[model samples]
Target: MPHARTAPALSLPIQDARERLRVLIRDLAVVRGRVVLSSGAEADHYVDLRRITLHHEAAPLVGRVMLDLLQREGLVPGIEAVGGLTLGADPVATSILHASAADPALASLNAFVVRKANKAHGLQRRIEGPEVAGRRVVAVEDTSTTGGSVLTACEALSQAGADIAAVAVIVHRADASRAAVEAAGHRYLAAYDISELEI
Candidate 1:
């Protein structure tokens, strides 16, 4: 009889990762005052996750934590690609790709970006990088408010023929993004909700 195969278990301590992320977010990403989101929604507080995702100290932490979350939560089974809207999802996706490349147990995953719209020239592609056709993917974002950015990215990915496995983000600012994502029939993961932050 053939034995059943299983995924390699995740062993990292998520609480430690959370503490590190919490400090990094508090010190570098959290800002007070009103700002308009990419969704055109106004907010009294802003979590500029790029502040951490782009950092030397925090970027790796974000990647490790996110990958850990995916693995621990059993969200990694079918995902072959990771990415979302250009700027926000860029670093997070890169981090996961790099980390996966170094880890033996994790599947080698490709990263991709979704343009807000198709380019006018060249390939005129809406989703750029490796081909996503027929692959399972997870849409990543630096922060979320209305979830509009992640949803748009996923829509493009789906149109490009990728099956969305889940949505991941550095911070969840409100309920809308989560609701919107789940309502679309995909699982969602957030490293930290706004309530977890000091600001």
Candidate 2:
């Protein structure tokens, strides 16, 4: 029998992924008019992440890029599970799960979704995962401004006794997030930064 071909490792330039993501944002996602940011700053354009996450083509591409980033940052070797705050982390986490599932070498990493709060009844558990305790985890997000959301998710994971390996996002808006993640002693990775978007 012919030797089975090894699956090729996926890779992409950080800049190229940013440009492609912008194209997807412009073509598929709607851009709201200029609006003030929570930081009291004026902005010319708005990026609705849902546009990319919900798009048929863009969503999968996002998954690939995110998985690629994890590999690029060297966190893939340490991560046992991937997840973050719900709604935003939902798609990315699912994508990571899919990529891992398709590759036997990567299949060891499981995916989970973190709830903003615990369930009202039954388990009343704050986390739902396949025994993430003591496991290394990387929290995924669509965007990060002040890192509050990511921090909250990290707190939850810490409470559950999971070591937060890193925080990876589709976009990193400011330096504050980088500082916070690093200050917390976790690796931080992003597919794009605000300046890279050329906005």
Predictions in order: lDDT: 0.84, 0.76
Lowest summed-lDDT stretch of 10 residues in model 2?
5-14
TM-score of candidate 2 versus the correct structure, residues matched by position: 0.82
Tens digits of per-residue lDDT, candidate 1, 1-199, equal: 8655322223346577668778879988888899987788788878888889888767777877888778877876568989999888999999888777767877878899899999999999999899999988899998888888899998999899998889998788889889999999878898788888877
Question: Which runs of model 1 end up more than 4 angstroms from their true locations?
Answer: 1-14
Please give me the total number of clashing residue pairs in predicted model 1. 0
Please give, for residues 1-199, the per-residue lDDT of candidate 2 as tens digits: 9755422323445456545666765565536589775456676776667778866556666776787788888887678889898887878887777767655676467888789999999988777877779898898888777787887888889999998888998877778888988888778898877665555
Error of 2 at 157 (Å): 0.5
- TM values, all candidates: 0.88, 0.82
